[model samples]
Target chain A: MNESSLPFFARGMDPGPSFVDVLRRLAPHGVAGSGAPDHGSALIDTVHGTTVVAIRFASGVIMAGDRRATSGMSIASRRIEKVFAADDFSGIGIAGAAGPAVELVKLFQVQLEHYEKIEGEGLSLDGKANQLGGMVRANLPAAMQGLVVVPLFAGYDERRGIGRVFSYDVTGGKYEEADFQTNGSGGVHARNWIKATWRDDMTRDEAIDLALRSLFAAADEDAATGGPDLVRRIFPTVAVIDTDGFTSVSDDEIATRAEALLGGREEGAGL
Target chain B: MTMPFYVSPEQVMKDRADYARKGIARGRSLVAISATDGIVIVAENPSRTLYKISEIYDRIAFAGVGKYNEFEMLRIAGVRQADVKGYSFAREDVNARALANAYAQTLGQIFTHEMKPYEVEILVAQLGETPDDDELFHILYDGTVMDEEGFTVLGGLSEQVHESLGATYKPPIDRATAVRLGAAALTPADQAPLNAGALEVAYLDRARARRAFQRLKGPELDAVLAG
Candidate 1:
């Protein structure tokens, strides 16, 4: 398609601020929920991602997701990324149907950038969360057809001078989590681990460790969630979003942490 | 039934062009200069909130001088177009030439067919990897597109401003020098020097990542102008 030209109107009827609204008006199908058709048959064989966790700490928020995609009883992909930067200061971790989940993240990223450029300012953290909720609501039709996409959004709230986390239901209901949130096939195990280890005033390092431990526990019990692969050098994606903005933790750091976790487990087994 | 008066097509075209030019000429002028770092645009806009320079895409920027509502409408349209195109194809595909052509088409169509032509002149600038690759397209109210080099000016008294810019136009200048030159050219002969507060500055610095457009205001603008 050609580049979009300026949209014209008589006067005062402009599609103000929202890029999604503009897309909805210009190309209805381009908007996420407006195009996906509902199917009768279940999409049971689709690639589904497991285990993603977000923890709010003293400085900001830590988002981590295991690098695995599963279809029914078999592994579909082992190095699938599930954590994405929604904007400079915000990120989203996906934990549901892999295809739709990735698409949702991409669309959300574009939506945020689009709004910022059009309005000449970034949206508030709350506004962004609500916007994600709206996108999820729009995906309800596909969600009903078993192509659900559930995401956890975390951002550093400039107004409040603190990090905030929001989790969404399949129907697009948003709930602001107080400390930490987790989702996916291994969500139960990961959530339990976080509940026992989470703290209100954890440091950045402690938050990262807790997230890694939670994912490790999830992978241990759930077949869909893959643990850190030493041979393949594949590790979970971990990102920190704070006042300085979103930055992905290096693979070496993650590997070192995973190795330490495994060494501790080995010591426990010996005992 | 009374017959409508026969107006010659030349007369009608001239009238529309004249009307559009008058509307545009009422606004203050702006200029875009290709610099060593990237492209620098300086406009004589005092209002901080109402911008005349904005990003259109990753490497493309849009600048306009004319009716506020009219140019702003064009700006939003350009944003929508670039975003949608980038979304559909790859990001690199959304360039200034394509956007310039699109603007020309829209403006030209409106100028010829509509009862009231849009009173706006716009610039679509794309900063390339090197100084040689930078593109500057100056589009007119009647959809005339000029692929400019070194520097281009827009809005009222553009001829005088263009001459001023042409006299001092030099390639591969630094950011500060480009801003100073543009500010000098924008200032009228009889008027005092335009201060930082009276100017709006933005640039597509190649050193910047993906989105290259940036605004220089307040102290930063002052620093650049002082240099």
Candidate 2:
């Protein structure tokens, strides 16, 4: 559909109809309907939480998330992507139902970028966080039946001229992180690891290395957390946001960094 | 009961049009174009926070002139629609024409059903990966939808500005030429020429992403206008 909507004239159409409305319009009882589906039902899908960590640096912020998805006790996906660019200036990571969680983040990303495009500016960080909260809250009924979703959001606000990070609960409670934050089953381990290694005004390199270490520690302990897979050449996703904009480090670059992080740790332990 | 005062429908319509026009004429104007570098929009706005242009979809952009709050509401509404559409359907399905029609529908509704017509005019821009794919749609306060070929001028004195732009709008102008054209198009024949200091610029750069809307101000704008 070339120039499908020509949105300047598309003002009368209410922000694309709501998903629930779409379901109601297309088929009243279609899949993704209102009720919480039964757990362990054939429709029940496994969820995986990739390790994601955000660290505040002297100049801006560094964010990283692993690329693994586990279903129940099985490695459901080894290369499931979790990190996404929410908009030009921000990033988001997902944990929980791999399917719906990814879906929510995708919608959230589109919503933020969409707002920026339509409104000529993005929602404030607080506004963005609230927007995500509202989306998660909308999924409350689904969450009751093992469809929980949690997300981490971070961005470089041009107005504030600084980097900020936010975390979410299954019920959409948004909490701003002061320095660094992590999410998923391995979150606690990752948070503590970062606490031990983090400092105010750290350089970008130090921030990235510390973020990598925190994720590794989390992966070493949490079943849901995935560390660097050297044999397969799979590594975590990392992004940096400065005054310029949001840019993710290449997978190859991240693999190199992860390899060095592991090597240094092994050497320090004399292993 | 006293008979309704003899007021012709034409007179009443003319009065409403005058009021809408007056409100819109007081605001700064903006110009937009589809160039080889992508879609460029230039506005004579001084506020860094208050923007006259924005992105509404992966490839669609929104530019409004007149009351900021009124246009901003429309902008938010467009965002909601585009985001929802992209979620329910595919990104490629969201286009400029459908959105332009929707805006027309809403503006028509407001013009007829609402207490007051929206005192604003808007432009929707889209950049294609290829030259033939680009689009520009200008929607008026009365829900008038016009497909702008290559370039269009918006806001107050648009007629005069369009006359100035003339047929000389060089097709597939580079970004630099597009910026010069837009800035020139907004300049009045009697007023002093506009420079970077008096203009706010942005572009739908057709970058390697779903959303390509970006605002260019400050030194980046300074460098562009200086040339």
Candidate 3:
């Protein structure tokens, strides 16, 4: 029964699909799948992130990302989707490469579901964050090629019955943010907004508004961050990760929030 | 070669087939059908966990009866193949025919090469985007495959179940009707009818997303059977 002697496949057998196997199978050739090349990948790529912020409210966690995606001095996309569903119980906000970052989120999502199905049990919140760290570390070679992906993962832990957040670097340095944290180009501006408005016991409404204001402030200062578009009807993606699951704030509600924010309401309200 | 009496190949094949059929006949039968809502699988198993019908992939489902361990292995293989193919190519490309063919090959190989043939009959059901394309591919113990359009049955007492299901089965039936049809097929009319608790049921819902696989349990299953 000892781990040292069992063959790889036999030891790894579970009801759900294997996440590592999927990663290995999906990685590009020898680049991201296995071996030492990916071993230190999280460190190799030094893609500087702008901002990512997470806030804890009465219900769960509120996560918001800017609409802009930047590469070097150029704005890659004005409406690049940065927030993604990690699972029903979680959501992830990425601030690195427009490509690999998104791919990493998708893989994370599949890994969770696959694990849930095969093992008949969901991985712990900490386990999921670590899995992301491993994936980041695995992408070292590609990260060196200017394809770095740094992501902020936030989710509601069903077992703990509370929302949790984790931030990662290109080299897979994972840190659990206790109160709040932000990453990316406009992260400084965004984080300041949260730091000022975030309260000790903010309700879900206050947290959401706080999250929106932070993103608005980020968009106001950084050209790389796109503010809410009244014409195209696009807004920064927002989601709530709570005890229930991850639910994206509907576009209609986002539009309303944007309208209210722009309608003479002072930008900085709460301390 | 042993200097002993040689048995004919025909005898060998016959013995293997009988062994497989007899083993298969000892278990319960399951019915797979393309319903209006989606594809339904009804297995006559008392134990809920030891399911004869299970998900192979997002769009594909597997149902088998006979030796539990043997069919369970095949179920895992089907899952691996489907997952591998889907990951490599597009999800839509993982069709019923491809899975059925793979099962046929493996089952055929085992039937001939191994001393014992797998005493199992399995079904590969896929709910296509359209009703016309929804297919139920049944694979028997001896590597025989049947491309069923509307409905089909497999495992022990198949002759009786299939005959019963065939009479009431209609193309593009609704979800509840399909469930009732499946239960009827597996139940002995001469005895008491099976209630929802006695039957194991799941469906490949067409109305859902890419992955149609879903289990019908608890009150929802009760409602369906009641209807």
User: Which candidate comes out best when scored by lDDT?
Assistant: 1
Error of 1 at B160 (Å): 2.2
Q: Each candidate's TM vs. the true structure?
A: 0.95, 0.78, 0.86
Count steric clashes of candidate 3. 18
Residues A55-130, model 1: lDDT tens digits:
9999999999999999998899999999999998999999888888887887898889899998999999999999
Say what the RMSD of model 2 is: 5.2
For each candidate, report its DockQ versus the true two-chain complex: 0.56, 0.25, 0.17
What C-alpha lDDT do the candidate models reach, one value each? 0.89, 0.77, 0.77
In model 1, what lDDT does residue B85 have? 71
Top candidate by TM-score: 1
- By DockQ, the better pick of 2 and 3 is 2
Query: Across residues B1-227, which tens digit of lDDT does each residue of candidate 1 receive?
Result: 99999999999999999999999988999999999999999999989899999998889999999999888888888898888777766798888888898899999999999989999999999998887899999999999999987789999999999999898887768888999999999999999989988899999989988889899999988988888
Q: Write the per-residue lDDT of candidate 2 for residues B131-221, one digit (tens) a residue.
A: 5688888998989999877778888888877877765576867877778877877887777768777888989886556557677888887
Cα displacement (angstroms), candidate 3, residue A61, comes to 2.7
Instruction: Give the range where candidate 2 chain B is weakest over 10 consecutive residues by summed lDDT.
Output: B77-86
- Candidate 2 lDDT by residue in tens digits, A64-131: 88777888788888888777877767888888787778777776766565555544445887888788
What TM-score would chain B of candidate 2 score versus the native chain B?
A: 0.93
| Ten-residue stretch with the least lDDT total in model 1 chain A | A1-10
The residue-by-residue lDDT of candidate 3 on A118-208, one tens digit each, is: 5445688888888889888877666676666788888887888777888888888899988787878788888887887778788777887
Candidate 1 wrongly placed segments (more than 4 Å): A1-6, A9-14, A34-39, A265-271, B1-4
